[model samples]
Target: MDYRMFKHRMVNIVERMKAIGGNVSEVMIGAPASLQQIEACEIKLGFQIPESFKKVLLEFSSSCNLRWVFPDEYQLAGELDGIFSGMLHWDLALLKELNDDKNGWVKEVFSNPDDEYDKVWHQTLAFYEVGNGDYIAFDLVDNSTDACVIYLSHDDGEGHGYKLADNFIDFLEKWARIAFVGGEDWQWLLFTSNAQSGLLPDSQSAKLFRSLLKLSI
Candidate 1:
């Protein structure tokens, strides 16, 4: 999608989210990044950022306010809390710092002391941290202009990335559709609960909504 269309769709999605009475005010739109900033990130990462993903960072680095909600099954395990959260764009500086830092959480996943940052994270560019050690990143192994969105679960160990979407745009489209339109049975429950509870739904209901959304991630 072009910049205009992308912006339009995002506005519509945000409105729908507001209508559901969720606390989306923190879903602040970001200022566009300069060409220099984008270039610097590309040079440091050694891979061209996907145009769709770049457009989002240029327009709104972080577009939504979402928290990680673990499914009932994993609640006791406490292993899925950071698998996914709201889609937020990372600042260029943070992205570079994360990519370059050898002692960071990213390094924990590629803990082989012999592995360099580039070699360890070469095919992945982490743009969103889900906290604890998980991330939402672009998979560059295919070297595509529009890379696939993948979830890197630190708790799950290396070589176990979960595929989320074909590309950044695809992921956004699915998020809007699911969160706003309610495709599955559980999703409708979330919408209805939110409507009845007036945005701040009960903890159990809200947890369900968040847990279901994480499935999409």
Candidate 2:
């Protein structure tokens, strides 16, 4: 996927999010990282960062503060913060710190080598914390490109990791759709209610929803 196109699409999504009462100011999009900083992270982690993931970090090292415009009823409801929020993407420095062999949380979580789950964690790179100790990471063992998005849930006993998407772009696109358009069940409910209640003009809601839909496509 074209990085430029992906960035452009994300910018458009943020703008629309603002239109629907999202707190744009609360959103923290960090400055792009330098090549030196990127290389430092790679060296520290001992594994090459996927090109797709690196492209996103180069554009915005960290992004956060995205919230649902509507009330809880209209939201997907999860312990994790909004995907657009910086919470999903770690700062390059933070990523390195998190992967530190001696002081990293990864070591603590994967301490039991005998445990199967801990073994899986060994081959993955934990880039984003999904609150409650869960993480969104890259499954280095399963995908040769090391781009597949996976969810590692520390809280989930036994069976923890789950594949989220095939790549970072796919993950981002899904995140945008769920955030703006709502999930499979919620999307229809949100659109119908907003249109009927005139909370958002029908035409406007339809337009924004259409724009969001196209992003996923």
Task: Assess every candidate by TM-score.
Answer: 0.56, 0.61
Residue-wise C-alpha lDDT for candidate 2, range 68-99, written one tens digit per residue: 34423233223222222222245666776555
Q: Write the per-residue lDDT of candidate 1 for residues 16-44, one digit (tens) a residue.
A: 44544434434445566877888888898
Worst 10 residues of 1 by lDDT: 180-189
Q: Candidate 1: misplaced stretches above 4 Å? A: 2-25, 58-87, 101-103, 112-122, 157-160, 180-217
How many clashes show up per model? 1, 4
Clashes of 2: 4
